[model samples]
Target chain A: MSWLLTLLAPILGGFLYGIERKLTARMQSRKGPPILQPFFDLFKLADKRPMVVHSYHAFMGIIHFVAAWVALSVLFFGGDLLVAIFFHLLSTSLLIVAGYSVKSTYSRLGATRELIAIAALEPILILTAISFYLHTGSFEVSKILTAPTSIFTSVLGFLALLIALPGLLKKSPFDAAEAHQEIVGGVEIEFSGFFYDTVYAAKWLDMLFVFTLVFLFGGSSFVVGGALAVFAFFVVLLADNSTARVRYCDMVRLLYSLAFVLAGANIILGVVL
Target chain B: MKKTIHIPIGSQHISLLEPVRFSFECENETIIKVEADVGYVHRGVELACTTKFKFKQVGYVVARVCGLCAIVHSTCYTLGIEELMGIEVPKRASYLRLIANELDRIHSHLLCLSHTAENAGYEALFMRIMKDRELVMEVQEAMTGNRIQFDYVSIGGVNKDMNSELEGVIRNKLGLLHQKVAEIKELFDNNWSLSLKYKNVGVITKEMAYRSSLLGPIARASGVNFDVRNDSDYLPYSELGFKSITMEGGDIHSRNMVRLFELFESIRLIETALDGMPEGEIAAKVRGTPEGESYMRVEAPRGECFYYLKASKGQYLDRVRIKTPTFGSVPGMIEALKGSNYADVPAIIASFDPCLSCTAR
Candidate 1:
């Protein structure tokens, strides 16, 4: 059961992304590819031999993919919440390094923006994790399920997850790094073939990682988790269709504003209730 | 000892949706110096023109320079050749050319403005402008038989004729478009933050703009009252009494405002030309090709796009030299970026509307 859940998290995340992309295309008034198109894209990319520009870029590629997978696997194991957050941060850090190693100005600027975005949202994420630990008296996901409380108050933590939602999808208004139509893939411009595929899957896995974090706030039930994950995916897709990308400076400013307001509200609620 | 800072902007570049490189030396946020290296465009059609084409074929070759502004390129080149050959285009042909060029201008300017707004973090404004641009594109496709690369202009005149029905459709659409453009203009003018981002940012002095030999809006923004249409009286432009709109401040805001105002000027030119519909043939057949060195200049979407052609006794031309408006403004742009903050780099670049393909070609 544990192994199945671990596999299912990434698979579900990847599947949702494929669906989201198709939905975005439809909203743009074009006939999009099949929902399984990303699977086919992954298969095609994997079949090609991975080419490296510098050996370190390839190393970052491996680290980014593996770290995200390991982070989500930690969630699946019902292990330490702090440990999963660290691994997720590790994956993002690796991506930043990869972006910096490229000679393109677009990639460098994008990496800089990604770093700023992380700075804006990481504090709120830590606060949400602490809120979970305070409510359940454990940092482990397996232990948090037994606490007696309705799903509504837990919605506070989910709102924190929602606040960081744009970062996870990397879609419009927050797509500072890989703005495909704008910067022509930004940090990932130099990435191609199998290495590109790894980064692509890692992106999907990162989405899964955050959605899994959202599901935890809802509870540990598989049915509720799956339903909430679907809900999160649709919300992100809607944003992608409706919004054009905001500049990195604007994105950071918005994130900070929302984080302080929502996270501060949650902190006050913890004091009163 | 002084350390020289080497920064590369693009080569597998993502920003600007095109490949262009800039190496700049900056002390803190102030740029000490800058150099533009633009050779990413690899289409060698001009060299191919020496063998695979005739004087008549030059229009098609010029149009291939860019997909988006193909009609502008073709019309400019054809107009230049026609002028050199002393062939007066029919009245209707000139009017049709003006209509096509102005419509192209609307789409091109809207596209640049939308991208500029997007880069500046103005999502709502960008979408609104882009939607308006789509209306112009739909009109273009309906009239020209293609969305882009209109191929409307030939050696002597235009290929397609605008009938009464097509004219009625375009006129009605233009009325709606004028209202939309007014709304967009109001939106930009009223936005305080947008003014802050643009006003006094990327300041290019009159002396600097002139020294760099800047043309079009970049030059006009600096208060240079020069337009190729006024200089040569090409097409229906001279007949319509086209206004050469300009501004004093040569900053990013002025550049944007000049373009914004020119959008209205273009519409006015089209409306006047369409109402005064001249009756005649759209094209004429050219027999002898005895052309010496002749040059022509026209205002492209960016600014003045120049084409110099030398024709031989036979079918192909001896040589074709192009000076895109973007290339002329490169020195001006680098000069403007001298002391602006690092955050304003993308916006400054967008303001110049540097079409790399045009520059590289």
Candidate 2:
């Protein structure tokens, strides 16, 4: 079952993304593309000739995908939460490395922006893992899953995670890293063909990883977990649709001032109350 | 010595709709110097107007200068030719021309708003505004027989007349569009993230606007209070009770507000023109060749679109000079870009609503 889930994460993530596109389209009063559009896009990308600036840049794309898949499997197999988080961080770091290796200004700018974003977001993620440890007295996902409803006790931390979700998913209001209009695809500006396919699939895997983290908050009930994930997905979509992207400085300030404080308060409350 | 990094935005870029390029000299993220190229879309329309096309045919040729404001191009050219021939367009034809021009303004303004939102990364707002803009498009099609590139204006007068069926359609669609536009305005005014991207970003002060000789909403946003619609009698603008909208901030937010208020004002003008439209010949009789020189200006959606025609009692004109709003405002755009963060470049460009097609032509 764990192996099957690990294999199915990307497909499931793609379907969810399709739904997101459709929902966004409906909100905009237009008929969106079909649900299988992401798969079609992946298949089309796979058929193109691979091009790369350097061996390292090309290699990093594959490594990024592999790391993301590893992170997804770790989450599915109920491994250590910290290990899964670290692997997820590694995945993004590899993409950043790839971005920086290119001489293109857009790629470098995108890589720098991604680094800043991860700096703001990764701390909150660590605090989330810590909050989970405090709630369950363990770092293992299995232990957290079997524990009582973590959200009930760690509501503040959950809220913090919710605030950080857009950054994790690279949605609008926190999507300066991929500001399409300003930087023209940013980190992905240099990627094409099969290498582009890997980066794109890795994005799906990353979405799965973060939403799965949202699922863990529900603790012991699949229904609650699924419900929480759906709600968060809707909120993110709404935000992506309605708001504009903020500057990197503003993004860092928001994550630190709002999400960091909330997570820190949650940890204090867990220790005291 | 501090070394400056150079960043080129386009001849081809996602943010830009036309083929204009800007190279920015930057220290860290702040732009220190800016250079723009606005000649990519030139097709020698001015030369064609004199050598290839006659005065009547030139109206249609110049209309191709910019698709977004095709009616204004045709109308301006036709007005110049009509003045050269000493022809007086009927009051009813003027009213019809006003309706078409204002409809074009509504759609063009909506397109700019949607584009600005998209550049700011508000994809849903972009789509929503575009969807709403279709209502105005439908009205244009119903009245003029084409959504864009209508060629509704001719040398002596308008080419089409409004019927009762078209009138009903215009009123109904305009009513729906007005409500939709109002909702969008509310969102633009109150949305926090949007305000963050727009307010106080890419500011062009009144001094900067004046010094650069900026026109259109970019100037109006800076409290310049200059609109060709009010300044010229090319059409029946004053009789239609036209009021120019201006704001004080001179930032992206103010530009957007100026456009929104102008949209409302356009809707009102169209509705009034429709109500008070008189019955007369759509086109006047033309017999003699145009002999004199004439300069005509129209309040295009972007700004003042000026056309200077010099004819010498012949089929072809001696000269046809076009001064597009975007061309006049290029210096102002460069001035606005200097001292702003590179991240704000797309938003600032979109705010200016630069129509490179018109500029290059």
Encode model 2's per-residue lDDT on A1-273: one tens digit a residue. 999999898899899888878888887777999998999999999999887789889889999999999999999999999999999999999999999998898998899899999999999999999999998999999988998888889989989998999999989999999999988778898888999998999999999999999999999987888899889998988888778999989999999999999999999999998
lDDT of each: 0.77, 0.91
Best by DockQ: 2
Poorest lDDT segment (10 consecutive residues) of candidate 2 chain B? B1-10
The pairs that clash in candidate 1 are: none
Which candidate comes out best when scored by TM-score?
A: 2
- Residue A272 displacement (Å), model 1: 3.9
lDDT of 1 by residue, B27-83 (tens): 543467778887899688778767787778778988988776777789878877876
For residues A1-273, what per-residue lDDT tens digits would candidate 1 score against the true structure? 779977776577678778776776676555678888888989999888776779898789888999999998988888898998989888988988999998766566667667777787677777777777767778887886555442466566566667578876676657765655444566776677889888888888988788777777656565676677778777777665545455567667777787646766775677578
What C-alpha root-mean-square deviation, in Å, does candidate 2 show against the real structure? 1.2
* Predicted complex 1: DockQ: 0.13
